[model samples]
Target: MVNISEKDIQLLQEQVISLHKEAVEGNAKAVKDLHQLLERVRSDHSDIPLLDAYHGSTMILIARDKTNPLDKLRWSKSGLKLLDGAVSSAPQNIMVRLLRGKAAYKLPEKHFHRARTAIEDYTFLIKRQIHGEGFLNTKRYWQLIYELGEVYHRIGRNQDASICWLKLKNEAQDPSFLHLLQLKLKLLEGKPSVEYIPDAESPISNLIRRAANATESELNNRLKQQKK
Candidate 1:
């Protein structure tokens, strides 16, 4: 195993913070600085797999969620196009395809098929656990599954969409996602469950429960108000 010191982690953190500031401010120098920082880290810890994953993940923010439009590259296909092609060759191809889907959302409606394909590839990667493919958080997995279901539903593939939603409901331990899933299931079953938002609270599980309760309350309120 390669030895990494606390000092190294601190240095990486500092670099990431600086890059974020520069990225937000649309500072061209910060863009160059990020490249330099990445190169420096690569030079020292060339063999670390996790570092590559971190970098790939960071690329998602830089390429998609960066604050400054001026700082944004014309950004075609997730800006994997802008970064070193070598960075694209991380342990697994999951991040690459996921990023492609993120970018695909901004593309023209005509490109939806491509977007769906990209998301499917990432989902497959997750299912196969390729390249450390992730569903680390239940919410993230369910979100993707629901999105996949949405696309499927649009294409009138009701069965495939149902499968996606069912898998999502099962994977989501968070009651909010699960509760939402139940409603979706009911609707698909011809019951038409109403939409609801759980109330916000501390701790993830409680927060989800609150969200579910909030939804029921909302429905009751709507029914009450409707008589006016």
Candidate 2:
């Protein structure tokens, strides 16, 4: 395996972060510009499969815009193919796996098989954590746990989801994350069975909605207090 320098990794991370911001804001031109930057990096470092994966994932993000549905589908499929090839070539590369897992998680229900691929990646990371080989005691670790919990809930494994959130709640010190876990747990508690119905919205979505509503209410209350 070709080794990437720390400086190179840092530069790539910064570029990816900027790309993510542009993608989230739906800036197609900025995303294209970022892709060009990545292409330059890829040309300079042709051995880095990670850059290929990033470029592919960025294309997927660009496809999320409300444009031609058929073109969007084509781009998404192309991205997934690139990701799959990268991962297949480097099965143990955590960075590539993370990219693929995140991309898979956002796919529609018609792509449940692809979603399962994300679940597999998350499961592998958790297993690595158990053996002290993966990230521990870090925000990234907790975020993975949270995402794994959401995946479990999405797939109707309520019990597993509850366990993941409970573990997170026990270990979490951050007030906001703890509150979110508590909300997740609360939503799970009233269910009669461990199996969540596929037709219903997942508890995670409810948690998000509840959190948003709480934030809005709090902001309104603060405004009222200011007026008083």
Candidate 3:
């Protein structure tokens, strides 16, 4: 494993934050500069999984600026592959897992396996937060919970989504998050609180339903075992 000084790590983190802000604001020159800084970090710490993941994320932003469809596809695929490798290599690293999960969640539906991977990571993170592990009171923790709720909502797990939102509503003090949680709760209130039952006529949907049910059953069984 490549080791980095604390100062270097802090600098990398700051640059990454700047990179994200610039990417969001479409500041091409700033994004380019930050991307170069990330590249230098990767070169210096070639074996660092976290840096690798961050580099991959930066690549995605770079891809957004590509004019050619093929170039865009190439960049996106390379970035995602790097992220996937980093996550696989450091499966227990919460930060790496969160990065991979969030990136995977934003990917297109054709990457179905990535969606499942994201869900698993988010579930593990949420469980960790619930058990008082790590920095549970931080902004990142709250944002992770909110993102998990959004993922659940996207994946047709309305009940799970509602549970996440309700938890956030009760514990969150940040006005921005609290306001969003309230809206989510209000939207979910009148809707059915049950698991989504897919149409039996669609084989693909039925398969998904069956798989979800099996996963839920396995999780419940594990929880029961842990309690014993």
Candidate 4:
């Protein structure tokens, strides 16, 4: 068996984050590259649940890129299974939860019934942030709130969604996020928010890009061995 070193794992993690960032940006080549890199990881360290989570996320990406319905369903289910296994193995692992939560959020809740999974993961992480126990920064915390609110809205929890959006409106510092939140809240209230155009790109796209945010520095920081 090949023994993967700590440094090697860190490098792999960095590559995974970098590749995933590109993949999220509609880069087809990057998606292919990510698949190859993850295949190598799976071959050498299939036992590592964190790596499995990454592989699972890549599978979801692949599924999204597929045009055939059967292929999409197959990949999505396989990816979800891997994500479920990883979470089952390390329920408290922040990265595992984040990957699975994001994947679950992207999935069609009507078909997968994974809204509850997304809600649970985001809620768990948010509670950790509240207790100052997790590594989520302000940006990610707010993003999670937005995603959680979205899931709530999908599941007919408008009041819960409003609470989340209101918290961001009251406390978040990012102007772009604030703009998007206002529109979302207005729309939720059955108001004509779309009539008020912003000075830049579409706020909905901004929110999607922000939700897909990933960076090597952020991943490196999160992947560090915390001092216990």
Best candidate, lDDT: 4
> Which residue pairs in candidate 3 collide?
none
- The 10-residue segment of model 4 with minimum total lDDT is 219-228
Error of 2 at 28 (Å): 4.0
lDDT of each residue in 1-228, candidate 3, tens digit only: 478788978887887876766774568887688778877777767777887777777676666666654555567678888888898889878777776776666543332335576778888887787787874556667666766676676566678888887877888776755766777777777666555534312332232223233433453353233223
The list of candidate 3 runs beyond 4 A from truth reads 1-26, 38-45, 66-70, 108-113, 174-179, 189-228
> For each candidate, what TM-score against the reference?
0.44, 0.70, 0.66, 0.77
- Candidate 1 local lDDT, residue 83: 27
Q: Which candidate achieves the best TM-score against the true structure?
A: 4
For candidate 1, the 10 contiguous residues with the lowest summed lDDT are 192-201
Model 1: lDDT equals 0.49
* Cα lDDT of model 4 by residue, 116-183, tens digit: 89999999999989998859777778778988987777766777888999998999876766777888
RMSD versus native structure for model 4: 9.9
**What is the Å distance of residue 90 in model 1 from its true position?**
4.7
In the range 1-228, model 1's lDDT, one tens digit per residue, is 457888977787676666745653446666556656665786777664434433443453454443433333333233434322433455345554554443333322232233355445546645754345443454455556676665454444556667878887766666655666676566567422322212211232332222222332453353233222
Give residue 113's lDDT in candidate 4 (0 to 100): 67
Q: What are the runs in model 2 whose C-alpha is more than 4 Å off?
A: 1-27, 39-47, 110-113, 133-137, 190-228
lDDT head-to-head 3 vs 4, winner: 4
Q: Which stretches of candidate 4 lie over 4 Å from their true place?
A: 190-228
Answer with 1 or 4, whichever has the higher lDDT: 4
